[model samples]
Target: MSMKLLAGSLIAAALTLAWGSPGLAGPARPLLLAQASQSAEDIFWQSVQNSTDPAMFQAYLDQVANGTFKGVYKPLAEIKLRALGKTAAPATPAPETTAQDRTTPPPATEPATPPPTQTAQDAASSPDIEACDRAAAHAMDDQKPANLPGVTFDKLDTSAAITACLRATKLADAPSREFFQLGRSYDKAGNYKEAMVAYKAAMEKGHKRAIYNVATGLMKTQRGVKKDPAAALALMERAVDEKVMFALSGLGDYYRLGVGGRRNYPKAIDYYNQAIAAGDSQGYVGLAIMTYDGTGIPRNRNKACDLWQKGSSLGDSNAADYSKRYCRYR
Candidate 1:
């Protein structure tokens, strides 16, 4: 779908959610601290992204359904429930009052109801209820991303898995992590322009990973953005500065290949070392490749193969392939 359409849809859906879009980072929540002009709507959607309690979700939707935004927001609650992989519990029907016509004045066609049995409309009109709901709703999801496969979806728990999916699947959104995930999802889904828009949103929130991601995983290969090696290199550098583990490998590639500027084998090796120190096995692959080519380091087939083996053990896919090729032959 076109970005305009997708964004419009998401915006419409966002207007209805009670807990949030399904995603977290606690201490590094830049969205709440950075954006100062968020409306109640903005605050409300953000809460939907973080919340896990089914009751809370149901209550928020009830407010939307009964309140002023019923026409626009009621359907939104349904969408949110579906996204959560849940069905909204059936609301209990209000009971008929027992006061006899003879004893008490007939209740008005629409009588004032008490707290527990208030209809959706009543709940919606209560600004105080929504305001009170903010105490539980506005909190950012504090859970970390789960370990999902790069190629497959996992059974994600909606409540705590909001941030986890954003970071892992890269298809969801709320704010920083969500923005980046949506960008990645768009890229994979062939919506390059939409991806760029989402990435830009993430970048504005000071997301280092978004900088690298917007540059096409540091390859200068994505569409929508003007692809320049120098620009891509600069973005990777920014991510590396933030100590993003994978960015170290990307920085090494820029220096090793003279992608953005003149080749600096020494700098490449330096970055490779940094990546290795940061526990990214790709660092070993890059450094080993340099060793194999006698670029910066003296040519040492044994040393290169050994590095490849180590990287392979650490789960670097390229290193595993390289190990079979070089270690088997040499």
Candidate 2:
């Protein structure tokens, strides 16, 4: 009997040591089940946290409905409440209390109250519209093209400036000077298309400089219109008629080169003479070449030599070479 009692005490001590002590051989079954439950809950929470869209969340909820979760699958609202550090009860719906025992009044069946009507001044001064207007003005002022000295017309960025300028002129009701300035800006920005449009608008407003610019620009690029050399010739002729010396020289070149129409040597010589009379050294060289080669007039070596000497003195390279090679009195 004493040996049996000793055996029973030993069995009880072994069972206590195996189940309760850290030095035990293996985990208790209940402890293993609890760990598994916690791990499953962690996986569920991870799925919820990683879900980016409603579809993914619904898929995860379906997994819970199919009993894929080893532990309890809490309601999403309860999860949210827990995330907010609130004490959340289980989602099992409570039994409905008796109506007489309810403290809060029932929701009204009537429609909601309408908002107050705004006055005309209040409507006009709406913050959203005012903010939009201010933003648009800021964009206009910020994006308008600026001029820089020494920057060539071919190197400018005109697309953004043209867009902003057009917006400012149309929406902001800018002045004629604004349109003219925008056209000049477009010209400087290398946007001939926008420049032509802007110049036309300015011309409609009676801007004379804009008219000159449009004519010159069309002459330069032949934008929209066909490349009419006669039109170009006529435009330069007008400038010449207005006593523009450079225009006279250009007309002489045009006639000499037969640019617009038939090559009229006499007309070329006549224009060259006019340019020379206007005291242009390049024009003198042009006339000297014509006389030296019997191109537009009778060959006169003496006159050629005199013109060459005059042009050479004024820094004309061709005339200087001619004076050195053919006009040197040896």
Candidate 3:
């Protein structure tokens, strides 16, 4: 599926989810302030890479005009707009204050004390973040790209993870990754609404793994998020571009199931093969299904059973069940 940015309202809505409201960060204000620079760069690049639509860059410029992505991405977005043969609308000038208004005395109040500044360590090194990582971090998360054998959903401590991640996300200097973990924690607990909120927040901050999660977990009928399989497919593709290797399996499923478009068996097989090559056991299950059904390849029960056995050995429950039920691979 070709990636495209949604309407500006939707984009802004997603950003609103991240900050709790437009122009207001609520309790997470300090956290957003702390990571603003990196988040802006990440969000800008991700949005730009996912689509070439001029409106995309325009939307970014609009965000900048409205008080986000001020320094770095603003110029870059303008440059992109120029390259695309479009020009950003000029900044709206502030209304000039009249001499009479300046002469009027404002109500008197006590002098305000500035709030204490928070450092990145306040959240990065937080014990709650550590607990969240220990309790719910997915093996395939980009944050731990090198660690591919972490706890599975069934083994996740949903309660503990949710508590810790929730605490971490509220910290004054929390990173976006904590929001991703919070989403995972809610997913494990069967709280789709909360999970969707957390995943969208993480996605807004440019968490690649959260992109995959939002595509697969939320962008479908009957999920907490409104159904939009086309958008989901686009997001999955973006995840692949971002080198979320596990997303290959997701693309395979999308193709095999014809969720966003017509079934393309060849594409499904190709994605599954790529995922398998990347050492994702879930890929084995997808290929096994195709082999067993003779969808794109010749029917080969033995080959399917072998594939399921391999996936089962890699800790995939669906593969284990299939292996046990058909292959007698106890």
* TM values, all candidates: 0.50, 0.35, 0.62
Arrange candidates by TM-score, descending: 3, 1, 2
Model 2: per-residue Cα lDDT over 1-330, one tens digit each: 332343334334433433444446565445454334334434444434333233333444444566754323344423333323343233466688997759768877898799866554453345432322222221112222232122233443444344344444543334443465557655665445556777778668655445445546655444333355677677667757656445566677668766668878888888888888887666877777788889878999889989989988877676788888987772
What is the number of backbone collisions in each predicted candidate, taken in the order shown?
14, 0, 0
Better of 1 and 2 by TM-score: 1
True-structure RMSD for candidate 3? 17.2
Worst 10 residues of 2 by lDDT: 135-144
Report the C-alpha displacement of residue 285, candidate 1, in angstroms: 0.6
lDDT of each residue in 196-293, candidate 1, tens digit only: 87677878866666777765543555443456787778888887887765889888988999987999999999999989998989999999999998
| Selected candidate, larger lDDT, 2 vs 3 | 3
Candidate 3 lDDT (Cα, whole model)? 0.74
Error of 2 at 241 (Å): 1.7
The order of the candidates by lDDT, greatest first, is: 3, 1, 2
**Reference-based TM-score, model 2:** 0.35
Model 2: CA > 4 A from native: 1-226, 288-294, 298-330
User: lDDT per prediction?
Assistant: 0.60, 0.55, 0.74
Pairs of colliding residues, candidate 2: none
